[model samples]
Target: MRGADKLVSDSLATAKRIIDPDTPVLARFDSAFYSANVAKAVRAAGVHYSVTLPQNAAVKKAIAHIPAEAWRGINYPQAIYDDETGRWISDAQVAEIDFTAFSSKAQEEQLAGRLVVRRIPELNTTKLAAAQGQLFDTFRYHAFFTTVEQSVLDTVAADKVHRQHAVVEQVFADLKAGPLAHMPSGRFYANAAWLVIAAISHNLLRAAGSVAGGKLVNARTVSLRQKLVNIPARIAHRARKLILHLPTHWKWATAFDRLWHNTLSPPQLATP
Candidate 1:
C-alpha cells in the first residue's frame, strides 16, 4: 500500500513538473483511495484531485446533505462527447441512485479558485428489454463540488476534470506495451517491475513527444511515436562518414531533427 501510494504521488508530482502553473490538474482514483491519509498528503501539497466515491454510508450521507432540488433541476447528466446519433441530450438516466459517503479531503490543499468535474457513461445497459436490437445505451451523472466561492461550476471546468481521467488508462496501456510485458523474476515481481519500467518509458515518451512536437498545442504520444521513434531509415556510408537515410517529407521532420540533435540523438542502443 505504501509503495503504491508513493507511486501515485510521484507520478502526480512528476506531471506537475511538466504543466504550466496556470493549468489546473485533476488527480483521480477509485473510491478506496478517498481516505483522509491520502487526501491530507495531497492537500498538503496543494494539488487538486477528484476521486470516485463508493456507495458507502459516508458518501450517501453526504449526498443526503445536499438538497434534492440541486440534482433535480440540472442538465440531468448528458455526455459532452458522444459517438451515437445525437448532438445534445437532455433526459439521460441513471440505472439506480446510490448513496455513498467518501472523503473529499484530497481537495483540501486546493485554494478557493478550484474547478468542477463530472463523469457520465453513455454506453451501458441492464439485462432487460431490447436485447435483440441492442446497440448500446448511455448513462450519465453530474455533480459539481469545489471550494471556490465565486466561480461558476459550469461545463468548461467539468470537461477538464472529466477528460483528465482518460490519461489514467494510457498508463495501463503503456504498462501493457512495455515493462509489464515481462520481468526477470516471478509473475508477481515481474508485474511490479513491468509497471515501474512502463511508467518510466511512458514519461520519457511523453517528454520526447513534447520536445518533437513543439508549439503544437495538442501533440500526443501516438503522433510522436509515429514521427520520431518509428522513423524508417537505412544506414549507409557517405565518404568516410556514416549517414542515416529516411523520408524527408514528414511535416515534423525539422522538429524531429531538432529533437534528435538536442536530446534523443547519439545514444547507444540497449541490449534486448
Candidate 2:
C-alpha cells in the first residue's frame, strides 16, 4: 500500500514531464491505492482521480446519508460478461455523496470528494441449491471516491466514466498473455528493459490496428499478433525491385495491406 502511493506520485510526475501542464489528467485506481498519501499526492498534482473505495463504516455511513432520490440509473458503456456464470451485465444504478476522506488525518490534510456508489442485483444462489424458482432480487454494492465535482460531471456521467477503468485490466491481461508471459532475465535492469520493449511493441500493434480501422481496432493483443504480425510471406527480386509476397486468400490480407500502405506512404505537406 505504501509502495502504491509512491508509484502514483512517480507516475504522475513522469506524465507531467511529457504532457502539457495545462492538460487535465485523470488517475484511476482500485481500492488497494486508497490512502491519505495517495489522495494528497493527487491533490498536489492538480489532477483528477477516481479510486475505488473499500466498504468501510465511514463510506457506508456516507452512502446512507445520500437521499434515495439521488440514485440514478445507468447503462454500462459495454456489457460485462461474467465468465463464471456465463451472463451479461449491462445496467446498474449509481449515486453520489459529498464527503471528506482521510478524516482521521489533521484537519488541514483531509481531502474532500464525492463518494460514488454503484449497486447491481446479486444472483440468487439459494434457489440454485434448492432447485427451485430463482429471484434476481438482492443488491451488491460498490463504491468509489472521485475528485470530480458536479460542475465538471454529474453523478451519472462520473460513474460511467469511472466504470471505464476496467479497460485498464484488459491492457494488463494483454501484456501478461503476450511478451510479459516470462521475465527472461534475472537482473532488475534487464527485466525493466524487457518491460519497456514489451510496452512499445504492444502500443505499436495497437496503433497499427487503429490505423487499419475496423474490428481489428479493438482486437486483443494476441488476436492482432496472430492475425496480422505472424503471417507467411516470401521475398523475391524482380525488375530491380524487391517484392514481398504474402500468402493468397489470407484472412487478414486486406487489413494488412491497408496498414502497410498507410505506414509506408509519406505524410502530405500542406501549402500555406
Best candidate per TM-score, number? 2
lDDT of 1 by residue, 218-247 (tens): 455555566678888889998998888878
Model 2 worst lDDT run, 10 consecutive residues: 127-136
Clash count of each predicted structure: 8, 0
lDDT of 2 at 2: 59
For all predicted structures, in order, the TM-scores are 0.48, 0.78
- Model 1 regions more than 4 Å off: 1-28, 35-50, 55-139, 142-169, 182-184, 187-200, 214-223, 248-255, 261-272
Model 2: per-residue Cα lDDT over 91-146, one tens digit each: 88888888888888999778888898987776546535665555545566789989
Model 2 residue runs over 4 Å out of place are 14-26, 46-48, 57-67, 80-86, 103-110, 123-136, 234-245, 265-272
* Candidate 1 whole-model C-alpha lDDT, 0 to 1: 0.53
